[model samples]
Target: MTLDAALPALSSLLGDRLCRSKSELDHHGQSESHFPPTPPEAVAYPETTEEVAALVKICANHGVPVIGWGAGTSLEGHALAVQGGIVVDFARMDRIIAVNAEDMDVRVQPGITREALNEALRATGLFFPVDPGANASIGGMASTRASGTTAVRYGTMRDNVMGLEVVLADGRVIRTGTRARKSSSGYDLTGLFVGAEGTLGLITELTLKLRGQPSAISAAVCAFGEMDRAVAAVIETIQSGVPMARIEFVDAATARAVNAYSGADFPEKPHLLVEFHGSEIGVGEDAEIFRAIAEDNGAEGFEWARQTEDRTRLWKMRHEAYRAILASRPGARAIVTDVCVPISALAQAVSETQADIEASPVEAPILGHVGDGNFHAILLIDPDDTAEVHAAETLSARMAQRALRLGGTVTGEHGIGMGKLGYMAAEHGEGWQVMGSIKAALDPGNIMNPGKLVPPNNGAVG
Candidate 1:
């Protein structure tokens, strides 16, 4: 029942694949966000599904917790070993099993990153559309049910992931869903596991739906005099059904940060960075319509990037926004808050949040996939300043409350890891209990990523 007791069997099972090095443990323990390091006792690398199953079985038999580790890009401490356990690092299991170009889906091992998958599909004239901007592993993206800018059009991981191969807590292997587009055969186990955050099982493989590369792509940047006007443009564009491929919003503060960091001279004003993907004529019409909507909402400095390199540079800035925001304040740590409200409530949410940030003691930059009513505020605070941390926390709590009040989710993309556990009860109410019941039934030993998502059980295993 002890981690030390389980080490011998794991060591024998994995040979050199079992790692107890301090550097490895430290690497697996930390997160992209501000969660303190809680490294696992050991890390295991399994190159095959059978190896993964066997590794899980040994850990289960010894009553040792097993946590899955992907690209270590999770902001909510989703992959960290909160309690001492063995982290099943999937770095070695990265292989693209098959590419069904006709069916428009690809089979890949858990460790394949979204970027890598897209790179592999480049020659096939198709690509995976779920871009979380982190180069995150496919399994990690599926586990968190991630969405990003492109989600406004191509959909999130929940819609793009067609099936999964999972290894349960007890080391039993099972497959959910199939290559078929839709299913009505039985319970949707795939959906259940997508956002489970590895509490129930570890995803070993994923069959993800793909989209054909668009014939034409056009991106633009439009600045607004006011934050409300920028949000108004987003709402109007969405309501107008312009079929935007990506529509992201960043506040004046964020725009300045990105401008300084990326060497792009953008006006210090609220801006919407948007793109359209379709036939050339269709994209032209969409761009025209979106321009009208933007201008109607007081948008100025409308800049278009129709060339490939220009569009890439535009998105590169958007993706590097977190780093840019961090650079704005040296030595300041961030408490990133994600909240998604109804599309109709988008303007009010952003306006109220901006007002709150203005009154707060910290500098919090706002940005997100506004087309989907999802946004994030990077609440910056000096790590040594207690008052600053408290103020940032208060602002984050307010944002979560506001999202719930507006009939939205506390997290639109980042899944509930240890960070947002407090809001689950309020967000889901009694339904949170049902989630616990499901976790208990499937993971009776509670070895799979304990201390996350579901209600806590005081570290009890089995």
Candidate 2:
């Protein structure tokens, strides 16, 4: 009936793998963004799905909260155990079970990271394209339904994930979907748990669709005289059917952070980092068309990367932009918030967000996958300054409200972890209540990652 009552049994089942040391608790408690550390009572490392099922059973019997932990790269306190319980760390379960290259799909343990999976697929001529900038575990990415720079072209994890093997709260294991490309099966249960944030169940394995390596690849960065022009160019390019593999936007503040942290000389102006993936001739044509569009939009400081090394460096810089922004203000924590609006309204959303940051007390760097009309603002704040934290929180709330007003979701890729839970009722309305009902049906005790995604006490809106 309690976490302490379940710990002894977990220790016996996992041996030393059930960690209760102060250091382990402290490590598992920390979050990437601005959340107070609230560690779990214990951490369990399960190597197999059978073990995960068993551990879940043990926790279920005692009504102990079971929080799934992946690579710990989540931004919204997704892995932190807000309520005292046992955190099932998946690091030991990171193994590629099977790679069906001919079918262009891979069956992998939830613990395997996107980077590691892509590295293993390098010789296979196929790769997993859902890169969320972080070397996050595939399980964690699926849990968040994550998307990133390449999502503009390849689509998000929601599209890439085909099937899942989930361990429900009561310890029963069930498989959803099939390896086949399309299905008219009973229900899309795979989709349900993909972004459920470990509320309904724990994902033990995933079957993901893959893409072949492109014959040609090219990346470029162009500076825009104005932010609106940069955003306008993105809308026009997407509307023109450019088939861009990636198109990212970074404002002047983010550009400065990149220059300072990565030692790259970028003009402190709104910039677009674009990439094209297709046949050699097709990519060339696309690049030329993109160039014309950029020129029409008054883009300058053109830098093209045709070589593999050059492209790698270009993306490395973009991927490291977040870290660079964090380094921009030493000792400051970021309250990173993202919102997706309709493409037509992106310019207004970005413009107003920029104005909000300009008027705010904290420094917030802006960057995102603008190709999909999704962007993030890294609101940096002095943790010790309550006023600064409050200001950042207010700005984040404003951003969410603006997105909803503009016909977009409060979050584009980031799931409804503890950070964005407040907006679910506003965004989903009565549908949010339906979600709580589903949660209650699946985990009646609310022992599965309680205080996240769904309402507390299973069915209540709260």
Candidate 3:
């Protein structure tokens, strides 16, 4: 498919909906993380499911690649159209179809952001709990299976997304799962597509599970003398079964970086920022149990944020921790990779990773949703320095392999976009090949987002 030839037909089909301007292409090409800008031939804004289906159909006829674009917050280049096709920007599809407060679910367009949905649910005493800190579109979140601090209790996109309206590569519209809860159902296609990274189909609409706002919420930070102690505290808390709403780990370096950037001061040491949400008594009990665990692990310098405003400020700072890290080092890009392991192996993993980082030249900051055994090392890089980029990638790859050895995944929430595609075979082995077969079945022409997720016929795509 000569991409230039397809663009004229795409423009004809989409009319003003098609974008090919330099600025628009540049904007769509870029990503939040360190991947180099790779733009598509054009960007398409589809307002409705039928619009998306029609767009896909046109692309299919021309053997043109189609990439799904959401809020463009993907850290792993999942939204980037590297092969140069039509980028279906879903921003114009922002709308809430229905909000069933009693059913505890909402029907929304792919572009409806998590923050917007929460705002609508404000008076209803219910909120969607999947907070990736980016205010990512619900569709994008589902595509990448993003989970943030609150995932310990509320679950990831895989759990919250009850159903999805997807346009197949050939423009066939299919609805997977249902608004009603749990179904033995058929082949579990919904699970397959939730984290497919848009290689199989374009997610147009989503039915999301909602959580009731807890009656009593408490947020606090506990600092430990050492990273080992802080990690131990997390393990103990989880093992003791407090059902933590959010439990995050920030290494001393990360704490210093975020504090410098966010202007929140504390003793610069390994720390845990935790939240408890439940009935008044239940939250109190969970906090008590957590306090005991922290003290046992030699945690000190504990600070409590009791008021709602104070709690929000605390969490907001934590969410912006990534920005803070980038600010600490002027003129540096980041290579961020997420890996999750068994809870029992978290301490070893963190210790080994910290050691590896300290031994390396790259300035790496460690942080994670510790309760879920998921963490990331944000390796600061100088884009102009090829050596620095390679070093950072080496560190990320080593840690990913280590996580797999511990019976973990290369990416816990961040889906296998372009970056982690290499590790798919190592993590899934034969099952990874099975995934490619599924992709072949769904997208025979490979007209969907190319150079991502599934491998080629014989071996790895890379």
Candidate 4:
């Protein structure tokens, strides 16, 4: 199994579509997060599923690694080509195949970004609701089982992705699920592959469930006296069954960072940015109820953005929170921590996490979709300072342990790429081994995506 042998066949098949230039290789190698660049030997741009199948067959023959690339926005180094092989970049395969407005679904190629899909669907009065803050590609979102602020209401990629056209490890194409919603047929292969993180196969197409555009949309930002109060408000809101469309939490440090980066005025206190979608009257009633709950939890400085421009500005600032946090510390890289606990345990979880960050030597800002008991602490550290990096790693490990201790998950949305592999055993134990067994069954050669989301094996070439 050698990349040298595979490149000749790939070049013969793709011609100029197969890229070996250093610039393209370096571009495909870079990650958005802190992982150092690990470039692939070559990058192949396949425009069709048949081409993808043929590419995989060629790689399988040579026993070379194949990694899929979408928009390259993943945080945990999900698409990095650590092993030197051919990276199947999906940039050319981006196309919205069909939109079945009557069925409230859309069939799309794997490379189309979420923003593009929504833009295409705007005229139909339907939209895909699984927004992960980033304009991430639908394929990448499904691969990660991603969910964000709207997931508290519309659910995650696991719920929105109705069907998938996947290319198996050995170049076979198969479709899972149907346009119709309900199914009792066979194993839930769609669900299995949704969060597999490319260890099993590569997703080529997706049929995503869409929701109707709401009549009235309302967004607001409310500040609390303390972090616990903001978290408590979220718990009470969920327990009260308010049906919130979105509810995100950001600590004081995060708010300050956003203020500095986005040029917006925000109180330097723990805040909950929330949104509601429904009929005009219904949305108003829900906001009233949420306001009452927040007030009960000692929330103050409540401000609503009722106009369309105001709402867009508010959410835009919230989506840019990660960059804002990074901007807080110049020349600092981040190790993002994603953890989710039961709604009832959220207050204690955030409290302990805030206390830990306070004690740490590095700056770690807390934020996330708290309505679903999911949150992140972006741990910033000087890349050159080994001691600072170690401190940040220790904080991340403790956060993972705390999430498990609180009966939650080590990863809420970010899958086990290269970052969170160590916590898999602690989180899933025997089940983790079962995942490896399934991987072996689907991809015996381990060429799909080596050294990710499964147990270690000799076939790993990275």
Candidate 5:
């Protein structure tokens, strides 16, 4: 039951694959964002499914917490080891087991990053489209159920991840889902494990649905007169049923930050960056419709980039938005607020949130995936300043409440980790208790990535 005892056994089983050095602990402990650091007792590099199973079995026998770490790019602290245990770093597990080009599905290990997968598939003229900006591991993305800009068209991890191989808390290996697209099978365990965030099980492999690379892809940018007008443009575009590949929003502050940081000369105004993917004529038709919608909402400077290099530059700035916001204000940390609201409520939600940021002490910059009615306000704060932290946290809590009120969710792409634990009760209500019940049923000993997603309160510890 003690970590000291578990470490030696894991070391023997994994040989040099198991790491206990202080440097490994420190690296695995840190995350991309502002959450406080929490180092695991040890880090294990499991190269195969069997290795992961053995590691999990050992940890379960001793009742030691087991943290599954991927690229460590999660924003909600899903990869942290707050309970202190073995960190299973999935780096060595990065392998593509199979690419069923005929079926348009690929099977890959948990540690394979998105960029790597896409690179491997480049010659196949097919791509996996669940992009969370960061080059996160496929396993980590499945655990968090991540969605990003491309999710509007291609769907999120929850949809693209057709099947999974999960190592449950009790060291049971199970496969959920099948190679076929749909099924009426029992329990739907694949769906259950996708967004569980490692609280219930560790995902070892994923069978992801792939899309044929569009023959004609066009990226465009349009600036709106105001934030509400910009949101209205997005709503109108989606309502028109335009199959946009991606539709992302960048507010004035966020645009300004990127413009300064990335040396792009875009106007400091609310802009909608979008991509259209399809056949030559199909993409052109959607582009025409999208441009008209934006113009109706008073959008200005409507421009499209057809060249691949130009499109890359446009998305590069967008992907670095979080870092740009941090760099905009030197020495300032950020509390990134994520909220997904109903489309009808988006304009109002964003307008009021903009006002709230102006009124509050925290400096917030707004951006989002507007096609999904999910947006974020990156609130800059001084982690050392208690007052600033409280102010930012208070504003984030308000946004969560507002999202629930609008019949959305506390997190749209980022899974509920420790940061959003406070809003679980508000978002799920009695359903929150239901989640805890499921958690207890699967991980009764509370040994799998404790203190995240499910808070382990309610019926979890009777």
Candidate 6:
């Protein structure tokens, strides 16, 4: 039951693939957000599912923790090896196994990034649409159940991932779901592992749903004088069934930061960056309907992007909004948090959250996919300043509570890692205990990404 003992076996199994270098350890230890560094004792790169299963068996026999790593873009520290054993990185197993163009599905290895998958599919006239704005690996995106701008139309990983090949805690390799679209299957095992964040198993391969490239694409940005109006416009747009391909909201603070960073002249007002996809006529009609709704809600400065480069610029700015906000303040780390509430309560939730942030001392920029009732706050804080950190923490906690109070989740897309563990009980109640029981049933040794997702437990199997 010793990690030190397990390393030699892993090294023998992987040779140079098992890395213990300080630089690699330090890199894997860090996170994109504010969580402290918690690196694993070693990092193992397995190029095949069989290798992963063997490595897991070795670690399980030694009572060692096993954490999964994809592209390392998760904001929730989902991949950090907190319990200190081995981090199984899936960077090399990135191959598109098959692309069923007629059936419109693709089977891929877990390590392929969304961007790479789409690039490979470009000639097929079909594409994957679950973009989380980071070119994140499909495995990491599925692990966190991630969604971003296009989620309003094409849905999240839960909808796009048709099946998975998983390496369980005790080293059993199994496949869940199938290429067939519908089934009366016994259990939704694929659903179970998709968002489990590698607690139950490590994902080795995935069969994903694909959508055809849109015949026509149009994007636009409109400004609203007030945040409430901007939110109200989003609510109405969703309710009216505009079928928006992507609808994102950015507050004045975000607009200011984006303007400064991207060198685009966006008036310092709350803005909705939107896109529509369909037939040429259909997209035009949808854009017009949305424009009417936005204008009715007091939107101004209606700027449209029809050409490829212009629309790319518009979305590029939206996708890079996080870095832009970070650039607005030098020497600052962020506590990036998000929540999803019912579309009806979105205005109230956003308004109250804005008030709370304004009253606090730290500067936090607000943005998200408002069309799906999800939004994010990037709370910029000087990590060295304890008071600023505390203030940001308080704001984040309050936001989680507010989401729950309004019939929502503590995290809309960002899964529970070390950052959001405190609010799990409040959100799930006894249901949280059921999750722990399930974890115990599946991973009795608690070696699969110990200290995450399910309730905490001593990582000991007796």
User: Candidate 4, which ten residues in sequence have the lowest lDDT sum?
Assistant: 453-462
Kindly list the per-residue Cα lDDT of model 6 for residues 9-36, writing each as its tens digit: 8888899999989988988998897888
Tens digit of per-residue lDDT, candidate 4, span 355-438: 898898989999999999999999999988999999999999998999999999999998789899899999999998889888
Full-model lDDT, candidate 2: 0.92
Kindly report which residue pairs in candidate 2 clash with one another: none
Cα lDDT of model 2 by residue, 24-65, tens digit = 999999879688898899999999999999999998888888
In order, candidate lDDTs are 0.92, 0.92, 0.89, 0.91, 0.89, 0.92
TM-score of 1: 0.99
Collision count of model 1: 0
Off by over 4 Å in 1: 458-462
Candidate 4, position 402, lDDT:
94
Per-candidate count of clashing residue pairs (backbone under 3 Å): 0, 0, 0, 0, 0, 0
Error of 4 at 110 (Å): 0.3
The estimated TM-scores of all candidates read: 0.99, 0.98, 0.97, 0.98, 0.98, 0.99
Tell me the tens digit of each residue's lDDT in model 1 across 190-239. Answer: 99999899999999999999999999999999899999999999999999
Clashing pairs in 5: none
TM-score of 3: 0.97
Give RMSD to native, each candidate. Answer: 1.1, 1.3, 1.7, 1.2, 1.2, 1.1
